[model samples]
Target chain A: SYYEKVGFRGVEEKKSLEILLKENPLDLEKLSTFSQRFPLPSMYRIHVWKVLLGILPPHSDSHALVGGYRKEQYNDILEALHVMRYVNCSTPFTDVCLRMFQLESQVLPRCSETTGPDEENEDFLSIARSMEEIVDDPIDCYWLIKCFVHQFHAKFGDSIPHLPKSLEHYLSQEEPRLLRHLKNTDALAQLPYGLWFRRCFAGCLPESSLCRVWDKVISGSCKVLVFVALEILLSYNNVLLGISRPEGVAKLLCNIPQENTDAIVTKAIDSWHKYCGTPMHAV
Target chain B: FLEDVKCQAKAELQSSDGRYQAQRRITQLLQTELLQLYSRVETEAPAGTASGSPPGGRADSYP
Candidate 1:
């Protein structure tokens, strides 16, 4: 009901989404093309992402399970954020959140001008606080979806290119010059996208831009995570090529490149299409 | 400026001693994560090769 009212509502989009959702084996190709171009209607993101990530089992009852999983886990992250801000840090979740903050502020791509030294907002806490019943803020959904993505990454890390290899492979094909420049940065010297990937590109991407990319990711393949990330990083090719140090490279990539999220998503789609065209490239 | 001060003031005023223990804890937390990431990925792909393999090893084809 909420999703019908708040998400997946537009007539054409609703029809398309309905037809696509009914696929038995899931038409990932069709799903991929559709989602890469459009954001899932706001209320519809979590479940679609679950299906795309294979977080939800391929069964008829997945729709019912989505609500239970989202509510329970969203509260857990909120509690974890509260513990970090108020109580003494004891568990692994606080550690994870802290790492998330560091990755965003330091190693992820961010804008230099707007990223002043302002850590005042219990930004995570406020994010948790602001979440509505069905969740408007997908940041929490990131933690949840990312849990699924991490499982996919880890389970497949040994098989598919792990995050670092994904980055190395993608860069080799797309941004050779920038790859050469970052050869020495401590972070990248060993694995440029390792920490970035472990953190699920949280700090590295803006919420809006990341959500758009996640839309494609949830529908098609988790491998899209690395490709879109590569897409984003390669979009910064000129900037990255100029910076030889890993720290500088990390900072450049960590900052959200610009405010126009749609532009970034559009560019990433082009990169995704091109990368996917060379079937064996980085997937 | 005010945001920084408020953030700072909140942490600083957390106790009479004026030390925000959370900063130290957070820094330590981040350090742990970096170490874990390095050990997990680097020992495997030191050369930064395009396959997720340990040194001198070949990647296994997916089943």
Candidate 2:
């Protein structure tokens, strides 16, 4: 009950967002403050994310081009998953961001091609180049895709040998009591991050909070995911550490209270900013 | 988009073209909890590794 964090109300948030949007290139510095608020307005969330992710075109594509890219997105995922399946496995959960992030990175030109943003912007240029390097290497491209899929199954697969590797990534820094609970077999099944990246919170958080997380991620980099996950755990740290069994710990993480969306997100944004001062440059 | 997925799922159910048979078959096989797909191909391959190795070889072997 004490965990909630205050966020901006309607008029204040709308005014902030409108100012950020008015600039021809989209005012990114203003965006940082706007995003930190958490639980952003619901209706404009998708449009806001498209801007941050560089999916929307500055000049609208012909309806056909928009339609074509959506089709291409689907085909690319099925194609990539086709590659994964041949390897004889499948991700435990569907990755909603995979095609949009992966396929877009591989096939679509970065903001330079997609949004036609300022060619001189260092962030856009860096994002574009990193994407190109991954796409250009066919071997590395598939390897990345395979890891995305295996991240879910490989960590949570029923086999004893395939214990949760992702848990070790961050849990090593957690309180020992929490770390012990996380290592339990059942708790690992409902791992907070799982394998899907943004999809991990798919049906979990408030729509507004969820979109804000995406905004931070697309505008910055993949480094935001781990920081955000850690923030969530910190909120329930003492309560979670007290729990004895795996199922109990999992139940707490799986059903995080909606009211704390504001707090969880605020902390996550701050930590993401602090830990990832320079974006890691990978998707 | 959901509608498109529903239609495709229906088509796959109604004996649609096997154009994506490999994709479909692999999804089906995964339900059996086979740890690795290509390994089965190797074991069952009448022609041995040369013929049995998957189109991409072992999925885990990817760099």
Candidate 3:
């Protein structure tokens, strides 16, 4: 009886009712009427309707069953479906919402003025927050660092080709505190090589004359720090990839005590040489 | 053979234009897709300490 009122033909069975809906979609008036009567539809029924709407041939169907909804309404429906445990069914709708959001954002006015010192500080804080969120997952950190490097490239242009140096200058100027924080947290020890490269080097350097400046800055102290950071990063990678124990690295590090920073620099250079000479295929 | 050469030249010109368009489209798609993917993950991921648990836990450890 209610089915008929909603433009669904069958009177007896729900399956017959579903068949009628499939064959003949309800008009807007009938849909509103049904919504008024039923109030909230079952998740399963909503998912079924979504699938039908997605796959139905364009321009052939008589009734525009779900045609007039806005992007936000569609997003709300998908979110509702997700909350109701219909995640698998909600992906297409989610994708549509994502696309719509992208389109809308692209059309919005761009902020063109150069960010002042305070704004830059705020940006650094935001970046720090993002870094903190991703610290535990090396894979995620790798991509996040890539994004940061890209942002630096966009801001400073291609004055520096070396990604690591560009990042070092950017970080040193924008958020020296982040570098200090990272060192204090021993985050370099836990990061993978790509992420470590991104964070420690790329986040720190400037875009101007990086190659010449980089060599100049690689003094004994900086060299020692870089070596320790690289070792930690490489060891983390080895652990993650099930590579053999970095015994060679350990032996090299053992030769240099923690206090002899100059010796650490020499040992680090030697260690890098030895590691680089190892068969590339082995890595 | 001359006609074939003309056709080939025409096709090459079309292909060159098509390739440029395709490359531009791919670049746009990649930029948009990567941004969307990053934002989606950022929104869905737990903030602060909640994300501190390693992804998929210790079972996901490399060794």
> Candidate 1 chain A: worst 10 consecutive residues by lDDT?
A125-134
Docking class of 2: incorrect
DockQ for all candidate structures vs. native: 0.01, 0.03, 0.01
Better of 1 and 3 by lDDT: 1
Off by over 4 Å in 1: A1-14, A21-39, A50-134, A137-150, A153-155, A159-161, A184-192, A258-261, A278-283, B1-63
How displaced is residue A10 in candidate 3, in Å?
14
The candidate that wins on lDDT is: 1
Tens-digit per-residue lDDT, A246-273, candidate 2: 7687677778888988678777778666
Docking class of 3: incorrect
Tell me the lDDT of model 3 at A279.
20
Error of 3 at A176 (Å): 62
- Model 1 compared with the native: what TM-score? 0.48
> What's the lDDT for residue B51 in model 2?
77
Residues B1-63 of candidate 3 have per-residue lDDT tens digits of 999998998898789768766865775676566556645655788456475442223222211
For model 1, what is the alpha-carbon lDDT of residue B53?
Answer: 38
Candidate 1 lDDT, A107-207, residue by residue in tens: 32222224444332233322322222234444444454344445544555554445567667888887676676666545455433543444444455566
The regions of model 3 sitting more than 4 angstroms off are: A1-19, A25-28, A39-44, A48-102, A105-283, B1-63
